[model samples]
Target: MRVLDRPTFDGWLWLDGYQLNKKGDAVTRRELFVQQAGLRKVSTPAPVPRRGGRQVGSRPSGQPPLVRRDRG
Candidate 1:
């Protein structure tokens, strides 16, 4: 598991390929801190999606919102 990004919270590492823990099995930083463990940090780059990589319900950057008018 390559480090895709730093932990949103300290002591937690996020990998490039997996995004679940949806099982809610992850313990908090208070429970366990593994900063100095076998983990190593490299100046590696984040993974980029091959396609446009737009997320659902996400608007494009810098575009104005649509204006709507109601006719009576």
Candidate 2:
């Protein structure tokens, strides 16, 4: 039987939801198969849809907040 090799870290990527760390230059078909076998057997929840609304602690939709002038 052919043995599979473990992944080695090469780079990292940051995104809104998750941070992905790429291992090695390119992922081969054999490596993919091995990776799938090594992956944890766990179920994940489906992504939730976004609702139209302003996020909390964010600036208001239109006009900017009042700017204060300093007097010397």
Candidate 3:
């Protein structure tokens, strides 16, 4: 997620995000509204380097993987 604009006087913020597919390519653009005080920074793991001609464990082309959603 990226901050698209400066925070407003009411502490509301606008953000931009990309929805990536299995190939790490951006498939959709998303806009988000959030509160400045409610945001937290998270540490993400480094990306794994490709080992061969293609990424390891990646599915074949033209096949979309099923996405599972968990209710918190």
Descending-lDDT candidate ranking: 3, 1, 2
Question: How do all models score by TM-score?
Answer: 0.20, 0.20, 0.52
**lDDT per residue, candidate 2, 1-72, as tens digits?**
233343444332221223322422223333233333344556754545445666655677696866668999
Please write out the lDDT profile of model 1 over residues 7-70, one tens digit for every residue: 5566565544433243433333332334545576688554453455677656687987656689
Error of 1 at 34 (Å): 9.8
Those runs of model 3 whose alpha carbons end farther than 4 Å from true positions after fitting are: 6-9, 48-72
Q: Tell me the deviation in Å of residue 46 in model 3.
A: 2.5
Q: Which pairs in model 3 have colliding backbones? A: none
lDDT for each of the candidates? 0.51, 0.41, 0.78
* Superposed model 2: Cα runs more than 4 Å off: 1-17, 20-39, 54-72
Q: Give a tens-digit lDDT track for model 3, residues 8-50.
A: 6688888899887665668999998888899988997566554
- lDDT, candidate 2, equals 0.41
